[model samples]
Target: MSLAPILLFTYNRPEHTQAVLDSLSKNKEAIDSVLYIFCDGLKENSSEENKSKNKLVQQIISSENRFKEVKITIQTKNKGLARSIIDGLNTVFLEHEKLIVLEDDLILSPFFLAYMNDSLNRYKDFKNVGEIGSCNFFACGKEFPTYFFTNMPDTWGWGTWKDRWNKFNEDAVFLYKELEKNNKMHAFNTYGAYDMEGMLKDQIFGKVDSWAIRWQAVMVLNNWLCLYPNPSYSNHIESINATHAKINMVPPLQNNEPTFETIEIKELKNVTEAMQLGYSGKGDYFGKLSKKYLKKKTKKILKSVLLFPLPYGIVAFFKKNKPKK
Candidate 1:
């Protein structure tokens, strides 16, 4: 079997980076797989504290060689996460036919690499299989197949073949315009739980920078799909220190190791009721809603505490307009 290389992207969180590396190294295929670590540089005019963390991350990766072959790329100029990932994928895919990808905050299950490599080989020739993901955020019923297909692609811990990845368009405008021209806006949103069109629009206006949203657009435009192993094989830590981190966004689902020896791949044209529930914010709606409520409530409370020096009326004004979470 040809082992796909592993590409890990990291920024300033050294502790999270170390924890993720330790979990990855525990994977059975760790010793045989090639590891490619991309350390993004500090953004221009970044604070001293951020620069310090970035340096620490670089140092930690440099000292580790857990995989069979370790390759490190340090960007001299800050290429934000999205650009760094786009560049890394293009460069690495050029060398290897397939590769597994991870970020600093995601911790892998011991079986993650095995499942990814197995699925990669199983569906490599299937033009519809764009990528294989280790995490399944959807709370599909306990009885669903151990592995299944969906049009949604997850970026947490994933792998893809060169051909599937080559379809990605870096130009958000190009993708948005194409989708708009085709009258596929509504269809794209139904493909997954979230509003992909809105995300693409944000990307176009520079409100947010994300490579996954564009990739999702490409997958929808090309009628491609992603395969996922039920019971997530990876856990997202979502470090509080990471910039723009949305902890528990989609919240991690239960992780279960499968008993099956082989994965069966097939075409799934429609979203399963389970997939819909999971993605549509309805699968685990109550639990997810509770989490969001708590997070928002806590943030508001913290703000109130921080502004205690203000007049009682001012704080009372904030309390009065508080939206029900």
Candidate 2:
């Protein structure tokens, strides 16, 4: 088996599982790498048949790909997403120094594997880089072929070494209370503060459950730079009412093309470059769509167009034009 395994997590959604696996099979380095499949056990409210059918998801995830780069971890009891990922990762790390992770829904480019492996090897020793990501949400504005930047961390296609994974504070013993007292919640605004460690306190206290938000918080607070592509590598798979997206912030692609990559090992400037790229693209579309009534991104720009009273503006917009009350 290869030293690094392509780690995959799957639940229900057999079709999505199959689609992502198909994409992985097409990836440039799939033949040489090992695929470590972690199939989560049956969930609550699911009938026995549904539980048994859970095998289908696993099969779809690992099916027909019995090559050098394929391994399976089937859980008998349901561990949930949080436990499964953190614990599954622990298991994977025991045998592999580095891991490339993916969920059942995510699709990747052929170069995605190549890029992630390259970054892992190049930045494995870079103290500031906690993770090497295969995805970024930035619009590839005025693409200059390739570039690098830091940003809010994503839980999509990503790779990391055992060193950084070991550094993760599972207990979150140090930073949780401090992050709250300092009013630094804004700093960890990848998706929202709901994803912040602020919300993870309950999960830690046996009140709730989650996985990724806290991990992102751990990585971000430690001053670790999460490397990202300009146009994003793996597109989100669970877009419509799937498990992950809470508010359905499925905005249209602003500048999806002209995606950026890293041509060489270079010191990153700051997270500003990626944000700048995204902002400029949206800004251009804001003006570009002002005249056209049906232009995309107009709704997004206008949704947050108001300055103060953010909640009120959003509620008012949603409540407008009643459906025959």
Candidate 3:
């Protein structure tokens, strides 16, 4: 494909969605891009949560500034996040070889799209690169703007090739069946306690779900690397409202001083090297368990002691209900 398609997943959060779109429109390069919006339908009519979905649809219709090129997909029925994403991706892959995926709550810098497309094109021949990710949450103590290596490409704002997308098991409804009964899903080692397998457990057994983590498991099984920005190419605006986010406080990293932009292709080598060392090949089981348990305990203490007076939980709840447009 001459250009990479951007796959946007949205539900009822029109304000956040609108903010995300605004960020996209202000990008340094917009005319050559294609934005494909996947507006999910309500899961069930008269459902209480459909109020947000209704507003999200209104925002999409109200947006006036058109990108260089844009295509939209509106589902008549609610397919839920996981299904809507897996299905929307399948359709996009039919037309484009590469795609950059974004959600309503994440905002990208002017160079985010450009960086992703260039990386995808540059690494198309390399099977080791499973995806392009801009969600740089950690401070790697590096001097450059970005880095890459390995990690399950979290879907906050990511890009991938059609070939890799096809490899994820989208029809994993009976995930528990495959895990305990049948034992077909592959497991990869992790240096922390939160490997793909535990993610699956959290989904099926722990009352959790997300298509991205499952896809990460598949990438891990295949032993592939996911590139990340050094200073983070994208920032999570939905941190307060995001259900899947582990850290839901006022972002310690939000600001407008340093311009976020992509650097020359010569820098990709450093990114690639760091990513490779980020994960263990065997799904570091003990580390995964340790990280998860420790983080859980820490969050509990933070909520009860350090962050007690602020009504953080209430604020987060309202944010969750806030419009995405």
Candidate 4:
């Protein structure tokens, strides 16, 4: 079997870059696989501290030679995470039909490469299989099969074919319009388990710049399924300097080799239900209501206060000036 090329994206997090690299180098197929490292350039007028950290990260990747082949691309200008990933994937896919991807903040198990290669090879011919992912955020329990399918794609540690990746539509406006036109917003949000629609809007409105959300939109719109190992093969170690603030308590990485099989393309019902409940919220009725509904309402109220502050300021002044009863 031809091992898929591994693409690693890094920025100024030296410790994260080094830790992920060390864990990846220990994978069983690391010696046989090709590794491509993309070091995004520093932003304009970057602080000296950031520049030094970026240089350290570059130095770390320069000395690495554990893979069958090592290729490095150091951008002279910052392309941001979205542009960096899209551009990097485009470049690698030109030579390889399929490849595995890793960011700077994930630790992989020794069997991570083996599982990715096996699944990628197994599902390469299946048009409906959009991605082979190693990060399973929800705990579906031991009853779940060795591997199952989900409508959402996981980018932490994933593999995909060039053909499928080509279908990724980065146009936030187009994606949002299509989802609304088709009345698939509810389904796109994993039955209200997540707020993917809001994220898509954030992307559209320039509130956030996230490639993963766009990628997820692509999968959801196409009705594609991403395969995930029961016991995830990757662990996301949240960094102090991480871009996003979502902290997930990922299940422990699978220490032993994982078993993969060719399952039907349909998503496992039990697993999907579990994911819905898990992502809906933390606790009971109030938790769900607060997360699913009140959060958005609160954001609107805050935005209103920020936008029209004079009236709110007057009220605040009067309340403060009024005697404390």
**Highest lDDT: which candidate?**
4
lDDT of 2 by residue, 1-325 (tens): 2336888888777777777787777765777778888888786688877766687786665565644657788888788778888888898899878998888767777567766777777777777878877555543434422446454555778888888888776665455765566555556554241345546666567666666666766776766777766545666665563675443222223233343344443434333543443433332211122233345657667666655467877788778955775
TM-score of each: 0.81, 0.73, 0.70, 0.85
- Enumerate residue pairs that collide in model 4: none
In order of listing, the candidates' clash counts read 1, 2, 34, 0
**TM-score (C-alpha) between model 2 and the true structure:** 0.73
Q: Order the candidates by TM-score, highest first — what do you get? A: 4, 1, 2, 3
On TM-score, the stronger of 1 and 3 is 1
RMSD of 2: 9.1
lDDT against the true structure, each candidate: 0.79, 0.64, 0.64, 0.86
Which rank order by lDDT, best down to worst? 4, 1, 2, 3
Q: For model 3, how big is the CA root-mean-square deviation?
A: 13.4
Instruction: Summarize candidate 4's per-residue lDDT along 56-142 as a digit string, tens digits.
Output: 999999999988999999999999999999999999999999999999989999899999999999999999989999987674347
* Superposed model 3: Cα runs more than 4 Å off: 45-53, 61-64, 143-145, 171-189, 204-206, 249-325
The candidate that wins on TM-score is 4
Distance from true location, Cα of 116 in model 3, Å: 0.8
- What global local distance difference test value does model 2 have? 0.64
lDDT (tens digit, per residue) of candidate 3 on 48-95: 666765665656744634666677777788787888888888898898
